[model samples]
Target: MAYFVTPEELVTSNGVDVRELGTGEQWYEAQPD
Candidate 1:
């Protein structure tokens, strides 16, 4: 199933300065403050 996220959740989960990886697949990189 496809996953959906809200803007608030994304910001909260990943913070405001999050990066994404796409090596063979897509994923979010959690950056520490």
Candidate 2:
């Protein structure tokens, strides 16, 4: 399965202004960005 979200939602939700996040075994953000 996969997860999806709109750019506006990402920015509004957590202030993430990125377009895409690619595949990876693990990902982490030490603190909110």
Instruction: Choose the strongest candidate by lDDT.
Output: 2
State the lDDT at 31 in candidate 1.
27
lDDT of 1 by residue, 1-33 (tens): 223335344333334322232221133333232
- When summed lDDT is taken over every stretch of 10 residues in candidate 2, the lowest stretch is 23-32
* Lowest lDDT 10-residue stretch of candidate 1: 17-26
Q: What is residue 16's positional error in candidate 2, in angstroms?
A: 11
Q: Candidate 2 lDDT (Cα, whole model)?
A: 0.34
lDDT of 2 by residue, 1-29 (tens): 23334534433245433344442222223
Please list the residue runs of candidate 1 whose C-alpha ends up more than 4 Å from where it truly belongs after superposition.
11-33
Q: What is the C-alpha lDDT of each candidate?
A: 0.32, 0.34
